[model samples]
Target: MYLVGLTGGIASGKSTVSSMLRELGCPIVDADVVARKVVEPRTLAHSRIVFHFGHEILLENGEIDRQKLGRIVFADAEKRKLLNSITHPEIHKEMLKQIIYYFLRGFRYIVLDVPLLFETRKLTHFLNHTVVVYCDPATQLSRLMLRDALTQEEAEQRLAAQMPLNEKRGLASHVIENSASREDTHRQVLRLHTKLEDSMDFLLVRVLAVAATAGLGGVLLYAAKMIFS
Candidate 1:
């Protein structure tokens, strides 16, 4: 199956568009979700983080206090890099597993919902199409401020931390304009879903699936012959 990388700036309504895609029956491998899972209480990433960041970043119940760790890492570039070095590998592994799961399920395509799809450029080469959900700057700013209850400056700082949406739009193979009403956004998502479903790129994945099945059957048949002989 082809992979679509879906991304947008902070508060750009990318998640809203992603949810719509899910409703359309697209399997999504969300990096944010996997990031959280990899750092859960007993995970290897969690142990490494605590070892490095110390117990002060943990809640009384022993789980990582994400907000506390976030504050620490956001202020220190080296610390932020260190944290990424620890978690990114695990996150990538888990996301790959999910992708393989969808591939084996015979999906036509799947979306990788990553907030840093453009910024990182790590997965762009592998994606058949990259989509950026976009909104006008004013709309994006207002949405972030209102949604997060952030002051204008705070919201602006958060937005400034990432690559601009305009840049991401330019880099994307497709852009979904999300500044309008939900109905408009829904229309865009529907069109995108149809486009992906109709693409001939899935033929490559289908071939691989057939090869994998044949390989498995050969192994099983050999094992059965040896057992009965």
Candidate 2:
């Protein structure tokens, strides 16, 4: 199975790429989704967060107030690191579980969609390939402002929280340029999908052939033993 790590800057369209891959039948294990799950009301991570950050970060429904937490961490680098220290390990564990499950189910390709793939420096052993969805900084800023209804300064702060996109591109195995129109992006996605499918097919054939040869050799050995006996 090929494990692809997909990452992008804020509003750079990582989710869009993930959606496209999903449409093409790629199984995705989203780290953002897993992060949320790990911090549920009674989870150990949640308890740790409350102890560190106080109970005011909780909502009326007893769930963590993500907005309040985001405000605290995004405004302070130290707080952000503390938050990551509490949640990252749990998120990684859950992500690995999901990946193993999909691999066991015979998935040809699985995407680990993580926004901080480069920032965490944890991609080395986890991914067979890394794909970065990229767009111009201005485009990302504008889209983020409009999408999240944030002021320019607020948007910039959020953007600053992540590593620069250009730096990430340098480390990526594949770059999906998202600065172009939707049609262009779609074409790139389709092209990538074709290449990945071809590679997976080749790998599957090789594995099956090896298994068949091994089985045949075992059977032949058994037959020879019976004849000699």
Best by TM-score: 1
Sequence-dependent TM-score of model 2: 0.86
Candidate 2 lDDT over residue span 75-109, tens digit each: 99999999999998888778777865886687778
TM-score for each of the candidates? 0.88, 0.86
Residue 75: error of model 2 in Å? 1.1
Worst 10 residues of 2 by lDDT: 220-229
lDDT score at residue 68, model 2, on the 0-100 scale: 84
Candidate 1: 10-residue stretch with minimal lDDT: 220-229
lDDT score, candidate 2, position 54: 99
